[model samples]
Target: MAATGSVALALYYYYVRGETQRGQFVGLWPATILGLAVSLNLEQMKRMLQDFQN
Candidate 1:
């Protein structure tokens, strides 16, 4: 959801506002957000598996 919002905002900045650099900067955020989400989810899954093993 946050990633989607970031994409929309990036588009708006790029096309509507004509701020190419700012849009490009914001465009990079979705990947970072998704990467963080994946990392956190993997950590949570690891904890869950450990709990089950115990």
Candidate 2:
């Protein structure tokens, strides 16, 4: 949801608002958000597995 919003805003900035640098900066957000989400989920799964074993 947040990533989608960021993408929309980025597009708006790039096309509608004509802020290329700002748009490019905002465009990087989705990857970062997804990367963090994956990292956190992996950490959570690791903890769950350890808890199950113990």
Number of the top candidate by lDDT? 1
Cα lDDT listed for each candidate: 1.00, 0.96
Tens digits of per-residue lDDT, candidate 2, 1-54, equal 888999999999999999999999999999999889999999999999999999
Candidate 2: worst 10 consecutive residues by lDDT?
1-10
Per-model TM values vs. the true structure: 0.95, 0.92
TM-score: model 2 vs. ground truth: 0.92
Best by TM-score: 1
Clashes of 1: 0
**Which ranges in model 1 have alpha carbons more than 4 Å from their true place?**
none
Clashes of each: 0, 0
Report the C-alpha lDDT of model 1 over 1-54, residue by residue, as the tens digit: 999999999999999999999999999999999999999999999999999999
Candidate 1 has its poorest 10 consecutive residues by lDDT at 11-20
Indicate the TM-score of model 1. 0.95
